[model samples]
Target: MKNEGMERLGKDELSAKDSYYINVMRGLSILRVVLVHLGLSWFYPPYSQYIGIFLPVLFFVSGAVSYYSFLRAQSVGEYLVKRLVLVLVPFYVFAALVLLITVVFYPERFPSGIGVVSWLLVWPNFSDVFFPLNQVWFINCLVVMILISGPIFFITKKRPWLLWGVIIFSLVVSLLNVPFPLYAAVSEYSFFSRLRWGHQAWQVLVLLGLFICGSVHYRYLAGQSAKKYALISIVFLIFALMGYFYSDLGFELKEHAKQRSLYYLFLSFFAIYFLLALERPILRILARMRSLEWLLLYTNRYAYSVYLSHTLVLFYVEQWLGLTDLGGQPFLALVRMFLVLVITLAVAKPLGDLSRTLAHTVRAKLLNGIIGGVRT
Candidate 1:
């Protein structure tokens, strides 16, 4: 019995070390989002749906990561401050830089009063204010999710039945195929969401569900063997396939995944499970290729910045490429992909670094100081 107990603890230690895999997922998700924005979802139908689980993967991963943060923080205030800085610091810096560039380089396109003020707040669909930053919709959602997450975590720990009820309501919203959109906001082109402000009040189940799935995984599923994860993945895959054809629970049109359904949750769960099942093999490969590992780490380091700024890079690249027939011109599509990735990294990395620096300063000078003052 003692030996078995020791083995379980050892497995958990290894799992904690392998937490870096979360970054690998983030790096891949951002790249997939870039591809989605570049018209891959429109032109390439085959694998897009598979990779389009990117958004779900991100939310789940965020939930899991936030669980770790939730465990460590000394108080709720520290936790929120950390969360806010983690997202908003780099974003505000990026917005300021973008606004400056527009003013100097594209004065006619310079934002006016509301557009100027909009930069201070993050919203799901800000395309009218500035088209390039449309992708920050993801950021907007994350901010709200983080704000509400503390209490949710408390319920999960203290009131399982209450949490389960919330989960049921969320799933009911998902299964009902509600026309209220969450992520896409009230945009006209969304899957079916026609109602206003659904993003705020109604979660469409998939969004909140992924976060819960992630939180649960952090608590109960973190240290499983690859085979265990693979088995779990198989179960989710069967459910996804079954749910897809029967209930239209997966993708809205099986083309663009702007709208998610209960089916997509199963699909995303499968994808994350499969990723976890790759634990041993991926580590082996990364061990042999230090450079590749470094690249993955680097990609993740600025992934948030990339998510916030990549569409901006895509817009410029498309303009430079003459907005040509990319579907017909394979090479141009490749060029578009390359230029977007390269230019995006060049522009985004600095903002990412600066954001972290600012956040760190804020933590030390503001957050920590406030906590200390209160204690003193």
Candidate 2:
């Protein structure tokens, strides 16, 4: 009954249709996270190069979803604190634990993991340090972007042109390489670097585009037709495939720009279209087997926890299988990926469930106290 809060939010706060899309998007995002990591070895040459295109799109979708939630929230402080507990707290805790493991338990990998100091302090680059939590850079970026966009969002609530103006300005700055004061000048840090992009100003430009797109979809779009959406998705998929194999774009740039922006656009459209096309049949099937619904609900609820813990499972698997000693071969690599995926799911399931339960309990307590005045 307590979980009915979602249904209530659907009926009262947001349109039922909109809430459903948000849930579907969340589920798809988690699935893509698994696929991107799991199938990394299996990806063909060009696809391999552009393998991580879905990541930024995840953040953009997060921006959209969180923006809606922020509108429903009580205050910015309350919203941010809640998100910190849900996202950042777990990330840092897991990061620390993994760092401790690598440093204290297996000292050899400590150097490898700790080598990510530049990523932590300077600007973002691919570092595998405390990978489970550290890999959540996308989510961290989303939270930061939302915080920065708050004022702009509030001011441009009904003024569409102003939001558009901000987005265009940021993009132009990126193209022109104008050194905006938007970047942080924390040169005193121990890991400062001269990286031009992924700095504050550069990130602001990327985040601004995502924010504007999310707002546009939220306010004006009425969702898409299924067939039309599928066509659009297929086109994007073709582009992704082409970009991976034929395009001359570097992996990093493709991951950040082409892959993310295009994937987000296509996938969002596809999901909306697919669900609309299947709504009646899907609802009927779910109604026929209510248990299936609970299974899905439970998996989705703990998806973030699973994502945050899966990498440790992979690292341990590598150690257990003596993967470090073996030279990489196609067959052996495939075997390793399979073994790691299985182990990761096995370990992530229970841990993820426990995390979800604890999160739910805390949320329930907070909601109770909010609905009922605090006691002495």
Candidate 3:
């Protein structure tokens, strides 16, 4: 953590009401993430395009929130434990249920080999390691960020020049034309081929860079006027539009997203700032509409569990119903996605409510035990 003087930013901390706006973004991000995971057809042109920036937005807001949390934390251990519990506990429960359902009901889809299980217990990325739980990558990535964010906070506070250097380096990594690392190390047929890089490699650097940017935003730019962010976002919007309309420019976020290209980087910046600018107006509109506001808040509140668990629901529902992407038909895709969405929401709400109760009652002791005696 930084000095008290740096930690305490008068009127700059994210108030509860201020954070509700953030939750708006969170709700939207996870919803789109789920839609993308539903395996919509490519014929839905620019369908995936809308999703490119959500992940970046997730990382950005996470970094911003992390700054506030880090400053408020009583100890580094506590900070780490709280964040870890929020992510890992729900995921563990979801994974166990997935395993039970897959093994007991659809044994054919159940994986073979203890080695793969080991990877799922730790990494849990894709079919290379686990099946249908590929959505877990974001959870794993968040854990990685939480593990390193403390050091990042300190670096940015005490040695900002060094942090900036790392940021610049990571931006380069994101913008590079190089293929994802570990592609050659593992068999091309294995899921590891799609893995970004080693612990210190590939998209991790770019993600960390954005995480740091969020922290910096919380630290230095939290209470700024909306016009400032709006103006900046407009510049990014123009460049992004240029890339979209003029293919020769190579600026399309959708095109560059999987590659993590330079164009995608600009698009990410544009999205983060654009949302910040709209926060106030959005909040106001929600305030006037009680039912819609409640729905959005509910989604935001339970998004963590829903986001993690929806893919499982999608897979199993499809399995039981014998549903497939039949000829990549858009109507079928939409119907399937809609069913999964409804089911996931119905299931996640009660679970999230129960989790909140547990969090209020025994979460302290539970998390403390897991963290080797850390008190939160």
Model 1 lDDT-worst window of ten = 5-14
**Model 1 regions lying over 4 Å from their true place:** 1-15, 124-131, 158-169, 178-196, 199-205, 249-258, 321-323
Clashing pairs in 1: 249-263
Model 2 lDDT per residue over 153-268, tens place: 56765564476676566445433332332233332233434443334434555446645555555444434454554565576556544533443335444443432333333333
**Candidate with better lDDT, 1 vs 2:** 1
The CA lDDT of each predicted structure is 0.69, 0.52, 0.67
**Residue range 141-255, candidate 3, lDDT tens digits:** 7878888887666555555446556557666664443444331232243454545334323456566777777766665566667898898888977876654443333533454
Comparing 2 with 3 on TM-score, the higher-scoring candidate is: 3
Per residue, candidate 1 scores C-alpha lDDT tens digits across 1-376 of: 2344345432323245546888877776777787777777767566554666656778877877776676667666677777778888888888777777777777877766766665666643354434556567667777778888877766555543354565466566666554444344434334434323354334433467677666666555566678889999999889877757756434444522445555666777788899889877988999999987876677789888888788887877777668656788888887888888788878877888888898888777768676887799
lDDT of 1 at 30: 78
Regions of candidate 3 where Cα sits further than 4 Å from its true position: 1-13, 39-43, 46-48, 108-122, 128-131, 158-166, 175-200, 238-255, 320-323, 326-334, 354-363, 366-376
* Best-matching candidate per lDDT: 1
The regions of model 2 sitting more than 4 angstroms off are 1-12, 48-51, 99-104, 107-134, 158-201, 227-299, 323-335, 353-376
Residue 298 C-alpha lDDT in model 2 = 47
TM-score of 1: 0.84
